[model samples]
Target chain A: MPDFDFAQPTSLNEALELFAADGEVRALVGGTDIVDQLKTGRRNADMVVDLKRIPELQRLEIEADGLHIGAARSLTDIAEFPVVLSDYKGLADSSVLVGSWQIQNRAGIGGNVCNAAPSGDTIPALLSHETSAIVASSSGRREIALSDFFAGPGQTVLQKDEILVELVLPPIPDDSASSYLRFIPRNEMDIAVVGAGSFLHLGSDGAVQKARIALASVAPTPVRARAAEGVLEGNVLSDELIETAAVAAVEAATPISDVRGSAEYRRELVKVLTRRTLGISRDRIVG
Target chain B: MKHISITVNGDQHELLVEANWTLLETLRDHLRLTGTKEGCSNGNCGACTVMVNGRTANSCLVLAAEMDGNEITTIEGIASQGKLNPVQEAFIKDGALQCGFCTPGFIISATALLQRNPDPSEEEIRTRLAGNLCRCTGYDKIVMAVEDAAAMLRT
Candidate 1:
């Protein structure tokens, strides 16, 4: 790794000012992604800013409106957080599934979203919960829907002078439950071949009033399965409807063949994962 | 280079380190704590596992500059005053190690787990140590050693 200047600012304003510099500035929470990227020459930085010291960016709390996840909070903190486990199981589930315990102790969800890998495990879960990104700069702060945050693989809409402060997820309504499932060749320590998350809100008449389905590892970006979501929006849970929705979910993907799996295999995984995640969500709601 | 203060294995040192040097390099080169081995410089392998601020972290992934004001516990810190830690003792008794390159990392990770949960189930032990890969020995004896260490700690 090449030598670079380092900054550990204690305040968000101070950190943003560092980002407001002339040369390339990299903000790292865990160093799980960026450190390797730098060592391999995949990413270059004139100045590396460590964001863990910033107070506001490390905040994790539940407000009246929703959950505010500070960018630097470790995956361990988020996975075991009580509100997350009870109300947002998909977020908790995906958080623990990230890396081994050692990696989870350092990596944070904010970094995962910002890194913007097409196979990022947490994005589909965040989308199911309708999360938003709050970006800050020396100028001011602005919030973008998580669905709209990515530009492409390893790219984000964030400006060179701006840093992501946190992610805010809307409160999960009553009669609702969410769960995430991914297909990995091994039981752990592997990237997702296809990941799926399902959020369902059941109506009084036993029909689905609201639904969200998101998939990963099947496109340039983690994508929402809108057609599958449409299939579930007004229907009750049945083996037949779930089968249809599972097949419909594959329509959102434009997967390419990769070493982990082939394009056709990923498409099949998308359907299987979508069905399983929906089943898990349904089980969580009534059981 | 940047000046930083870090507490390693109950000793404090203020030193200058290149911003690019990883904590693994700092521990092995400057501090002469070579017990922590660097396997994959990337975060994939946990061979360089160490305790940073009481949590297990891959030293190869952390910058030495970031260790400022951080408390570190490397494998050299595990045994105390010529007495082997319970995990280390159990590894010896159960023959859990082979070539032993990965032994230090496995011990550090196991010690951290026992500190948190003194009575972790076998499944819990396997899951917690998933980051540290030991290729020479099948995981059966390693798992047994952790269980033995838990019993040793309880009594």
Candidate 2:
């Protein structure tokens, strides 16, 4: 790692001020990703700002609008949170799969989103929940939809002086449940080959009222399978319909051939994961 | 260099650390607490595991400068007084180690699990310890050791 100045900012203002005056400053919460990147020289920083000490940055608020997750809270805290496990189960599921117990205890949801890894397990889950990013900089703050947040692999639209303050997830819909599942070669300590998250709402007529399905590792960024979702809504979901929707979910994927899997295999896994996640959400709602 | 005051294994140490120095490097170098082994140094292997404010974290992934005013527990801190902790004794009884490079991390992680969940199921133990990798002993013995530790601690 390059020699750099380190700043542990206790307030959001302090953090923003550090970034406001800095050269190559990187904001870190858990240090799970940034430390490794720095050690390997994949990323260099003139100064590294630690944000976990800020109290407001660690706020986990449940309000009428939705759940406001403080970006600096550890994944373990988020995943095991009562409200998250019960209301945002998909986020909980994906959060636990980020790394091992050790990593999970240190890694933060915001870090995963900010790292902007195409294969980040939590992105699809957050996207499926229609989450939004609340960012703050020295000048002001801005809100952006999670879908529009990512610029590319390992990139976000967040400016040099901006830090993501919170991720806001809308309230769980009525008659709805969400689930996230990912395909990995090993049982643990591996990145996703194909990850899928589904949020389903059913109506009295035994038809799907609303559907949101997002996929990870299929493109340069986590993407919503809107085509599949469009067809699922207002349709009476049968096994055949589910299978067809799964096939449609593959349309959003533009996966590359990598060591974990080939492009063809990833597309195939997308179908399976999409189907399974949808089925799990449906079952949770009905059961 | 930054001056940081961190409590490790109940001993408070005020030391100067480089901005780029990780908690693992600081523990092994400045404090001369070499019990926390460095493996992978990228959070992949848990050989550098330690308790930060009572939570298991990969020390290599943490900067020593950020740990100021925090309480940390390493393998060196687990055994109380002159007696081995239950987890340490159980590892010996179960013959859980081969090269033992990963033992310190496993011990820290297992001790943490037992602290959090005293009656964790077999699957729970396996899942919790999965982060600490062991190439030798095939993990069965380590799992057995955790189970044994839980039992011993319960008694």
Candidate 3:
């Protein structure tokens, strides 16, 4: 790891001030990703701007508009949080799948998104739920849809000197439920070969009023399968209906073969996961 | 070099270290607390696992300065007056170790899990120790040891 100055600012204003003074400062939250990058020589920042000390970035707030999850809030915090589990079960489940308990305890949601791995477990869940990132910079703050946040692999739309302040999940539509599912070669510790998340809203007559489906590790970025979602929207979920949607999801995937699994295998798993996730999500909508 | 002050195993030490030094390096080199072994310097392997602020963290992935105000418990802190902690004893009795290089981290990680879950199920024990790579013992004895320690802790 290259040498760097470390600064721990006690407040958001102070952290911003330090960031404004220097362009080379990189914010450090959980150290789950940054530390690994530093040690492996994959990343080198001249200064580490420690954001853990900033109290504002650690608060999780649920309000009338939506749920605001602090950028620095750890995955353990999300997985164990009752509101998250009860309201956004898909997100909670994804949080549990990230690395190990030790890593989950230190890994933050913002870091996961900003790391921008195609296999990032949280991205599919966020995209499925129509979440947006509340990004802040020295100049100002703005919101961007989670779908628009990722530019490509290991990249995001976040500008230099800007930090992700919070992930804002809009209020769940009535009679709606969401679920996330992933297939890995091993169990919880390993990254996903294919990940899928689904959100389904049912009408009074038990027909699907709206549907959202997102996939990960099968594309350049977490992608919403509009064709798959179109199959479910305004229709009733049946075994045959879900199979058609799942096939559509496979058509939407752009998986690349890697050490984890072959692109064809990933596409197959995406079909399986999409079917399973949609079934579970539909059940939640009805039950 | 950067001067950092951190409390390890309940003792405060003021020392100067390289700017890029990790908490694992600081403990093993600067303070000579060699009990915290370094495995995968990245967060994957838990050989450098330690309890920071009552939570298990990979010491190798954490900078020493990042833990200045936190309370850290390493493998060296598990024994009280030369007496093994119950978890350590359970590991020994259950034959949970083979090479013992990863023992310190396993002990620390298991202890932290027990601290949080008190009486975790067998599955919970396995999931919690997933980060700690133990090439030997096949983890059967390690899981048994944690279950034993949990029973001891409850009683």
Candidate 4:
């Protein structure tokens, strides 16, 4: 970690002004990733702005519209929040799996998304939930669909002068449920080889009224398995139907081979995890 | 240099820290608290685990400037008044460590686990200690130490 100026701005406007002043500034949230990047020379900063001090960025609230999760709120809080756990189980599951318990205590969902790792656990879940990011700059504020937030690996659409303020998840329908699953060689502390998240809304007749599937570690960014989702929408979920959709999910993936797994193996895991997570989501739907 | 005030192991210290200094470096070099070992310097290895505001974090990943006005409990803070903490006593009684490089981290993690969940099942103990890696011990003794520590604390 090279020497840099650190500023803890108490307000979003102040943080924005600091960011506007210097393009070399990086927002320090959890520091779980940024600190390692600094140490490895993967990233450098002349000035690091700490956003945790901003009151708005630290809030986690459940309201009529939906859940407003502050970008800087710790993963531990998001994972354990009763409303999040019950209403957004897939996001909660991913949140709990972000890192170990210690990492969860420091890492924030906002940082997780902003870091934009292709293997980020929260992105798939967020994508499935139709989450939106509320970003703020000195000039104004804007909301972007989380699905459109990431540009590529370690990249997001956020400008240098903008900060991700919060994530808003619209209320999931009463008949809807979601699940997130990832394949890892080890039980813990490893990045996902392939990750899948499914959100399903069952019609009164037990047919799939709507379906959303998202995957991670398969492309430059987290992706929606629109083809697989198309297979499920307006259809009944059966073993054969689920298997067919899983195959479509495999088709949706564009995984790269590396030390963790071969591209072929990742594609296979995508099918398996997609089927399994879809099943879990279907089972979670209330009568 | 950033001037930060922090409370560590029941002592208050107001110190000047370089912006690049991690809490691990500040603890080990500046404060001379060497118990918190630096293993990976990254978040992967838990050797530099410490409690910040009652939650365990990798000190290597935490900026020293962020410690201002925060309560930190390192390996040295676990014991009280010259007495070994229950987790430490259990580890010694169970011979849970070999080489001892990862002991402080494991102890701190187990302590935090017990603080949150006083009576954890064997599976819970295993999951809680997963972040702390030990090469020498096959982890059976470490698991037993945490269970015994739980029982001892309960009594």
lDDT winner: 2
Tens-digit per-residue lDDT, A76-129, candidate 1: 999989999999999998998887888899997889999999989889999999
Shift of residue A283 alpha carbon in model 1, Å: 0.7
Q: What is the lDDT of residue B11 in candidate 2?
A: 93
Each candidate: chain B TM-score:
0.98, 0.98, 0.95, 0.98
Worst 10 residues of 2 chain B by lDDT: B121-130
lDDT minimum window of 10 residues, candidate 3 chain A: A16-25
| lDDT values, one for every candidate | 0.92, 0.93, 0.87, 0.92
Candidate 1 residue spans exceeding 4 A from truth: none
lDDT of 4 by residue, B13-49 (tens): 9999888899999999999999999998888879999
Error of 1 at A120 (Å): 1.0
**lDDT for position A42 in model 3:** 80
Best by DockQ: 2
Question: Candidate 3 or 4, higher lDDT?
Answer: 4
DockQ (Cα-based) for each candidate: 0.86, 0.90, 0.78, 0.83
TM-score of each: 0.98, 0.99, 0.96, 0.99
